[model samples]
Target: MGTDDGMQLAYYIVLLVVIGGAMLFELSGRGGQAIRQMMLWVVIFAGATLAATWWTDSGARQQVLEGGRIEIPVGRDGHFHLEAELNGVPIRFMVDTGASSIALGRDDARAIGIDLADLAYVGTAMTANGEVKTAPVTIDEIAIGDIVDRNVRAWVIGGEMDGSLLGMSYLRTFARVSFEGDLLVLER
Candidate 1:
């Protein structure tokens, strides 16, 4: 075997032993109490997981709204994510009604071929982390499945944000936007 490979193997073995020793020491000091608590937590988590699975699968889910509509299911964290195409590139956006316009993070804006240095940050937006600069721009197209929009107004936010936001600007294009149970249903 190569000398470097042997050295790396030894290093990994030592690291694992150290971590295992620390865990053993901590568990031994707790006199089996820590282990019992861990087992209890595991049981509780398993029960909750099974119950949530059953609850969601129980009902006769989502009959189509008359003609047709898009239904976004709420995540376990209670947020709705819509998979969309921005300027023909696929992306995911979090549905945020509180946001006035569609706000894109730096990376996403760049991915859609926006040159950040060329844009002017003249507008400001009040966010949870305080006000931040915004550069207004028109996106050529944004599409969710068959629903497509052209020349949509959006902002490239200056500071960090969780991700792109699908705000009222886009949501308003639909005839109706409603929430039923944990689903965000959009009627076009």
Candidate 2:
């Protein structure tokens, strides 16, 4: 079931349990006071559940750029993932501060009209898996929200990658890059 469906089911189940307990108390001669107390508890539970759901579903944790700054929430994997337009094509990149340059996946490079076959794999990078060959390329423009950079240096990895890496090459251009709690903030 979807998240919303599961949340709704949980709400109904909690409500039923509260009503059942309240009815039992009334039947045992506890009277209206017991029912009222149980109802109050039920309302509190529902409100808490709704708040939790809203926090997760509201996109409040997603990337947002305002003025000359960009704020991105840490993903479930503990990395900041942001979407940008690479040479006018949409691409998702994982923010990697450890990387010296932007590393683009083969598929992402191809999607941006890069001639993969013509690329020279002379550069090599050491990844968690192993050392992989890379081809140097320059993107005309890379835009995230309203922030845009032109002629950004990047490399296309010879091996397959889950997603492109937005490394220090692009990030260092910003005036400031820091993490605040679970958010990564960039200022230019």
Candidate 3:
């Protein structure tokens, strides 16, 4: 192997062994009670650190009609409820600027009582894996927080996907978009 590459691999191996040994030693200390308590404290401290990091990193707060919208905490999956519904139906959509159009999952479309057959499959979207054909449809309404839009163009993503995505098409209507760390703040 090359000298630099070999040295790097050796360093990583040594680091892992040291860390593993330390962890094992720590686990075996004080008849396991002390070790357990220590582990608990470590977990608590880690969680607190993560929470603090998320709070500080998430961008500016959004003041919508009711009150405000805050960033969703890290590791806590699902969309944040800054507001209630999108297009007259309760929806929690992840904000995705990469999407060219606002995309809705099949379930969400059905919940909103939108007829999938009426929409035309007008475009092909390039995804991470490959290309997926998308159908285009117009929603009569979409409501979030206090903001509402009418006659919005949306793409229906087929298959077992659960949630809809709010993309730049609808987001552009907002005055400002800010993200701090994991938090995305949208202002209208």
Candidate 4:
């Protein structure tokens, strides 16, 4: 078989294995001895598969290399110390350039004591679930990763977002950005 054919066959095998495992687990809900043995076999197979993949493949290494922006070693604190906030509400943001403007969660806005009534309803925002109404507000300050900006423009969504997302509205102002593993490096 050709390389493409081999790849397709491998994909199908993987899919079949996944579906079979799910079906087996569902059928094993009766708590029989045979079902318990089957589950043990499945666990062994999963571990063996993971070990084989790690031993035979460099895809994970290649992906890590390609996706690197900056590499920061783990600090003593065991967590990254990044400065970030919008309108006095602390925001846990991942640097996503795909977003057009600064996005804030409704609850987060309220937490920071943002008066939603003062914001202007500009338009609708297209999200993963559906469209949501948005209001524009000028923030007094937004600090991130040790950097702080004043009078930032951000949009408040009608519903709850996963968290406040700091996107292009903030990232665009940076001169350069890089990540060293878990550390984010930003230069303005």
Candidate 5:
């Protein structure tokens, strides 16, 4: 199971333990009024726990502010994926520290208003699949969370890619990029 599923399972287990303990206490001569009050509090606590879990799992918790730094949670796929605005258009990027430069998928480039017809596929990059031709481009702006960079160097891969890559070219701009537990922190 994924982290989300594991977390949910843990939550349920804790809830059951709490309820079972409450029942045992009630059976052990705890007053009916006290038991009822405890059950009410337990219900309230469970509701709050569920709400918090939902909110955290909803993606809002992925963007965390730590002073001037931003932390992105590692996704279920074990990758740090983030939503960024590229040239005024929103795009999703998978963090690839091994990549020398930012690499945009053809479809992502098109979505960001890049004209494929105008691009010259003169550059080539070696990948696990094979060497793929690419077209160099300079993004006008790329923003993630509150961090923004201008005139960022990137490329449009000539072949198909699952998603745009936020490579070292972009990550190196950060003052520090480190992984702490499951979070990737970008400091500027």
Candidate 6:
């Protein structure tokens, strides 16, 4: 399972432990009030975590702050995601600092108006999912709200890709890339 899955399991374990403790307390002449309070705390903690996780990926949307800054709240899977204009078409990309360059999947490349059939998949890249063939391409324009770049070099994955990766090549254009709490901030 993924990190999120592990975390969710841990959360359930904690909840069960708390409930058990509360049951013991009630049996030891405490009362239903104590059990209720304990359950309330568990509910509150879970709600907060769920609410934070639900932000953005569930439609909170990226915030284009003033002064060329963009903030993307972390997704439920604990990764940064941004919806950017790739060749003027909106495409969601997962921020991956480990990636050397922006990597696009077949469908995303196609949506960006790339003619995949003509692409030469002579290049290769080693990813977490092993090696995959790539086709070199230069995007005419990519925009994140008001921030825009032209002639950006990216790779079109000729093999299976989990999704498009917003990698370091594009992130390097930002004057600052930092994380504030659960939000990933990119400032120009």
TM-scores for all candidates: the values are 0.66, 0.69, 0.57, 0.52, 0.68, 0.69
- Per-residue C-alpha lDDT of model 5 across residues 5-121, encoded as one tens digit per residue: 798789788887887686667667657867777778778777987897787677634574756587888876778888888878889788898899999999899998889999999
CA lDDT of each candidate?
Answer: 0.80, 0.85, 0.66, 0.64, 0.83, 0.87
Give per-residue lDDT, candidate 3, residue 93.
70
Model 6: per-residue lDDT, tens digit, 1-188? Answer: 64567987798788778766766766666577666777787787678777866763375578998899999988767788899998989988999999999999998999999999999998999988789999999999998888889999999998887669999999999999999988899999
In TM-score terms, candidate 3 sits at 0.57
Candidate 6: Cα lDDT at 71: 91
The residue ranges of model 3 lying beyond 4 angstroms of the native Cα positions read 1-84
- Which portions of model 4 miss their true places by more than 4 Å? 1-83, 179-184
> What overall lDDT, based on C-alpha atoms, would model 1 receive against the true structure?
0.80
Worst 10 residues of 4 by lDDT: 59-68
Q: List pairs with backbone clashes in candidate 1.
A: none
Q: Estimate the TM-score for candidate 2.
A: 0.69
Mind giving the per-residue lDDT tens digits that candidate 2 earns over 1-188? 64657987887798778777766766666667666776777788779878876876565455655777888888756788878898889997899999999999998999999999999999999999899999999999988778888998899999978779999988899899999998899889
Model 1 off-target regions past 4 Å?
1-68
In model 6, how large is the Cα lDDT of residue 120? 97
Q: Where does candidate 5 clash, by residue pair?
A: none
Which prediction has the highest lDDT against the true structure? 6
Candidate 4 lDDT tens digits, 20-107: 6776777675668657766676777668767865764422211112222222233333432233656666655444566788887776
Model 2 has an lDDT value of: 0.85
Q: How many pairs of residues collide in each model?
A: 0, 0, 6, 9, 0, 0
Rank ordering of all candidates by lDDT, starting from the highest = 6, 2, 5, 1, 3, 4
- What clash pairs does model 2 have? none
Stronger candidate by TM-score (2 vs 5): 2
